[model samples]
Target: MSALNTSVLRPAGFILMGFPGIEHLQHWLSIPFTVLYITALVGNSTIILVVKFEQHLHTPMYVFLSMLAFVDIGLCTAVLPKILEILWLNSKDISFEGCFIQMFFIYMFVTLESSILVMMAYDRYVAICNPLRYTTILSKTLVCKAFVAFFIRDLVLTGLIPTLASRLPYCSSVCISHCYCDHMAVAKLACTNIIMNNYYGLFVALSILGVDAIFVGFSYIMIFRAVLKLGSKGARLKALNTCGSHLFVIMYFYIISLFNYLVYRFGKDVPVHVHVVFGVLYLLIPPVLNPMVYAVRTKEIRHAFLRHFLPRKIDSDLSHR
Candidate 1:
């Protein structure tokens, strides 16, 4: 199988659905992403390093943060280089196998990430709502259990689902308009009658994405109930304060996910670039932004940043002075 590009929509179709903005970007868009990526790299790498070095951050929340940063690193590494390479060289020529591999890891990391967030919510809920029982609730045993659950679920979603999906035989154009191996992209290229394929695709999507959404929602529901009962408004605010980064990450992921599904189903005539642009943002932003948001929001991370980076910056400033 090989990748090829053909317009999925004719002019009449274009008029109805309009263009999806995946491939469309101003020259300036790359500049911000460049800065954001460097920020992401530094931000996430620092989180990893701090967690590894600091005895104080050995708690469950920081452990989850560490895993989340690692996942972010994996996610960015998977997508960013290809994106930068393609943008600079104008080469989006991903091979059939290479595309599938990309999809597998991206899928794996995304699922893993969702699970990590769930673990973090549980960690925070225990910390805020059950201060005395927090250690018992989120013990070392329990954290390891959570990690096992994360990877097990991750494997099922990314590996099992894609394995079955790939076996169906790709009989269409191999050129995945977007960067990675999306199920819909491969499904569209399948040579076989794809009714069964589509069914499986939707089924798997609903299972992984659907189930994770439910868990995160449930965790927050419990958290909110606990928050509402706090006598002090300040206490309630403090409880929610930890959720800020997580909420941002979840909102970012789900909105893009819903947009992608909606565009694919309803906006068939949208331009390839439109789809490319949004998908690229969706894939890259959370991984990069998550560390920055979390670090900025929390004292521990802020202190870590200052302890780690500020001294270097200060030294440079003094050198110039």
Candidate 2:
């Protein structure tokens, strides 16, 4: 039936195979996926709300954190709900235009999140290496300008991906093997030669992840040097401690991302479901863990979270008692 329908230059829609080999287990999969989605939603929302309300947390670091949380929420919302619908409702069809829209938001938020992490690393570097001038260097104007610049960069670079992919005539099977509208997965569905799309997509991924990773690593190296030069062991410990959450989040983001990228592109002998599961995880895990890591590790965020969620009397009692 699908082969007969392939005569059309562009199909009406595409079927998102939630997990290609384990279709029978989609119901079971949705259980954990729902939990993750809800966790990400609540966790990132709490970060944004806490940072917005806590006047003392309005520094460049926390401001960047809130930006990250916002990106996380956007990234999750872009595809997770569609995934849930596919898994639970068995509604796997996505219109041609809708798929590109999902691709756009996913890439946009992912890029923004990467750039924000770089900014956050720079924020940490300024705070630790040049404390006296931290405020002056990372001024509101500077931060705003940096964010705007990267945001525009994300828009230009990521927008081209979907735009170019869309131009390709998807006359082949309109079944996407993965959960959501992954750029490469969708590009593979096109009947035309997709080498350009493949190369450009790989280029974009490397540019965002590779360059950002290098800058972040360099920033930390400089930070470590500055920390070692501090007068006391306690000061050095405290300085490194401040970066613990950010470092964890960065490692978590990059390691999983790099592994998933390699497995998807190179691990041809790997199972399709494994690729799909990792792809889902690639988007899901960060949003779920980022706020939890920060909440557990950052004192200011923890306190503000308690003050907001716990009742006044209970918060006071917990703090005192």
Candidate 3:
């Protein structure tokens, strides 16, 4: 019994199902997934490079934006390679250690993203509510400190879920039903009692995502209030416009995540493919859209992009003329 239990606890590996019910479609699905991965890589990398090289973009807001791009890159990179392999090559085997490592990084990147969003909200709040002190409040030193705080806070908090999960005695089937290593999904495969895992996962999810969302919402409310008190219509529009990208990002991240959580918790009757598809969407969509949202919606980013990419075209056109 003891040897049997040990063997069960430490299985060889897990088989990740890319898209369970639609195996035939995985090749087709890989096309879009590959496109999204490339887009996220190129887009976020461009943002980071722009923020790094452009002197005018050395401000706190752009600094945070660059950090967000960095996070998106990490988030997508953590999951996409394995996903693409599973989809395109049918290589779904992941060692237990590999699975835990992936789980850790995925959760870490997600937590960092949530923290960055909260910091962005605070940055906006300070900029709009106290423009005079904005520079003083979110100085380079403060931004550095905020970055450290975000890393440490999320590292400690979100790490708990994956850490506890890794320690669990997984005595059941060594198969995960989704593309990547989701904490809840993996934990659910344990044959032993998983009430602790479930409760703790819920706690961490709420503490990070739920609390961050509430704070972000509150920050926006304050921003709206400040905008309303502005005497001119143009001022209100300008303020709201500054927030448009961040607000859209916040909505995009949280809404899909919330829906995924709901389906995970309550949609047992729903089709497995639906859950898998939504899971993929939840992970992939933000990374693909975030940079686009910022670039298209933020005037500075648009200007920077145009300045970076259009000059060569313009010079070519001039030479032709």
What would you estimate as the lDDT of candidate 2? 0.87
The true-versus-predicted C-alpha distance at residue 219 of model 2, in Å, is: 1.1
- Residue 92 lDDT in model 2? 91
Predicted candidate 2 versus true structure: per-residue lDDT over 176-251, tens digit per residue = 9999998888888888898888788878878888789889989988988898899999988987776666687787
Model 1: residues with Cα > 4 Å off, grouped in runs: 1-28, 241-245, 261-271, 311-321
TM-score of each: 0.82, 0.92, 0.92
TM-score of 3: 0.92
Q: Evaluated with lDDT, which candidate comes out highest?
A: 2
lDDT of 1 by residue, 18-38 (tens): 112533553355577677777
Give residue 205's lDDT in candidate 3 (0 to 100). Answer: 74
Q: Best to worst by TM-score, what's the order? A: 2, 3, 1
Clash counts for the predictions, in order: 19, 0, 0
Model 2 steric clash pairs = none
